[model samples]
Target: MRRIGFLGCGKIGKALVRHIAEREDMAVEFIQDPGFINDIGVQCPVLAKADEAAFAGADLIVECATAQVLSENLELILAHCDLMMFSVTAFGDPDFERRAKALCGTYGRTIFIPHGAILGLDGIFDGGPVWRQVTVETVKSPSSLGRQDNRRSVVYEGPTREACVHFPRNVNVHAAVALAGIGFDRTISRIISDPEVSTNAHRISLSGDGISITLDISSYAAGAVTGAYTPYSACGSLDRALGNGAGLRFV
Candidate 1:
């Protein structure tokens, strides 16, 4: 059984913990979430905020925590084992992104960025150097955006970096798009909170010298901030990252 460590046990993390609880192929080593509760039947050690040293026992540590947590323990996590990142928005900071990649080299550890709550990430990544411009326009229910607005409103608009700063939890897909396509500074991010939309929607537009492509992805909400499909995405990412060898990787 693969020993797995979880950095957070929020909605998505809890869902994944339950999903793999009974699996014969994996075991939960420990969990480090301040807000974690054992509502489900599965049992594991709930680590404190300062006990990251326990991570050395994990084959792969899944980070379902916030960008801030990831940033704080970047080197420590990489020193222990491979990491599957849910908070891709943390890379919105060019310095952090660069440092993370460098540490992956230093520690011979891998950082896996998951395709969360969206599709067509492969094509976006394949565009690579040819990508001159890229934009991710996301729409979420007003409640999802932490607002009570009854009508549609553009909550944020700017470079992907700034957008991630403004709406870290909500517009992570845009940050993923930026990483896969052009870059944080070049990629455009537009976030809309609309009561009319029944799903969390992301529309990606890629423009290059001779190519123009658009992709639209949508998912229902399981919570105000968690997408119904996100937990499954995390599971899939974990499966793919199980035995990865060194360096930065996208799952």
Candidate 2:
């Protein structure tokens, strides 16, 4: 069985553990969460520290924690095992991405980025040497916006790199689009807060090589918290990763 280590025990990490536990080919061996060590119980090894020993026997480490956790634990994780990061938005930091890539090369391991909450990637990659333009509009209820309540508003619009830097918490979708199409600087993103919309919506459009594609997806809040649907969609990407010839490609 393929041994896996998880770097967070939040909704997505818990979902991944549940998913892997049911699979015949993979088993979660280690779980790390600073916030909730006892929540998952003895079903798996739980650790408070991020270190090679914590990840000792795992074949792969999945990071579903915040970008801060990722930035701090990354070197240790990469040193011990191959890594799959759900927080791809952190890569928008050019310095961090460059250093991480170099470290991965030095450690002779691979880093995988899940699609998370973006679409039309296959089409974008299919058309190589392509130029991509994207606009991301998010519609969420006032409660979903947290403490500050606005009736409806456009919060941000700019290059994906800047958006990722300014809104690290919301970078997954934008980062996914940026990595899949052009680099972060080339991808356009817009964030909107709409009280009228009950669900989260993502719309993507790409035109290149005589092909134009558009994808619009709306997902209801799966759990009590906001941003629940993104991780559920990320689960789909994980499924694709484990399937043969099922990996996503533009072509």
Candidate 3:
């Protein structure tokens, strides 16, 4: 069985922990969540810090933490073990991609990126020298947008690199698009807030040589109190990508 270490206990992390706990092929050996150390409360072995030492005996470290955690803990995670990151938006950082790749090379560890909320990625890399572009239109309720609550609004539209800076929370799709197609600067992204939409809707359009594809996904908030995306839905794509032996294509 594969021994897994989790770096967060948020919606996605908790879901992954439950999923792994039920699996015969994998075991969650350690969980790290500084904010909720007491809240997790004997669910599994918990760690206080996000560091290589904390993850030292695990086969794979899965990061379901926030973007900030990705930025801070990425190096430690990479140095200690194989890593699969769900916070794909962190790749949008100017030096993140370069540094991550370098660490992977230096430590001889694999870094996996799971396709969080983008689509048409399998078809994006079907051909040669593929010059691709992506545009994301996220329509979410004002409550989801936070602060802006009055009317439907276009929150942002620009290169993925710039968009990541403005909307870190929503950049996973953009980062996934950038990594799958070209790079962050080349990929386009847009965010919209619509009060009429009760669910978080993500629409992605990809155009390249001889092909233009689009995907529309509407994800409802899971728990009533938290109002976050369903962990199963976000992590489902990751499970598929990992289980199918597809290398970071969907991530």
TM-score rank, highest first?
Answer: 1, 2, 3
lDDT of 3 by residue, 138-205 (tens): 77776665645578788788888888787766567667767777778877888786777667777878
Q: How big is the positional error of residue 234 in model 1, measured in Å on the Cα after superposition?
A: 1.6
TM-score of 3: 0.85
> Which residue segments of model 1 deviate by more than 4 Å?
243-251
Instruction: Report the C-alpha displacement of residue 77, candidate 1, in angstroms.
Output: 0.6
* lDDT of each candidate versus the true structure: 0.83, 0.72, 0.70
Whole-model alpha-carbon lDDT for candidate 1: 0.83
lDDT of 2 by residue, 61-174 (tens): 888877878888888888878888887778898887997999999999888777665555665555546654655655555555452544678777889888887677655777
Q: Please give, for residues 180-246, the per-residue lDDT of candidate 1 as tens digits.
A: 8888999999989898877888899888889999888878883367778888887777767775335
Considering TM-score, which of the candidate structures 1 and 2 is the better prediction for this target?
A: 1
Task: Specify the poorest-scoring 10-residue window by lDDT in model 2.
Answer: 242-251
Residue 56 in candidate 1, Cα distance off native in Å: 1.1
Clashes of each: 0, 2, 2
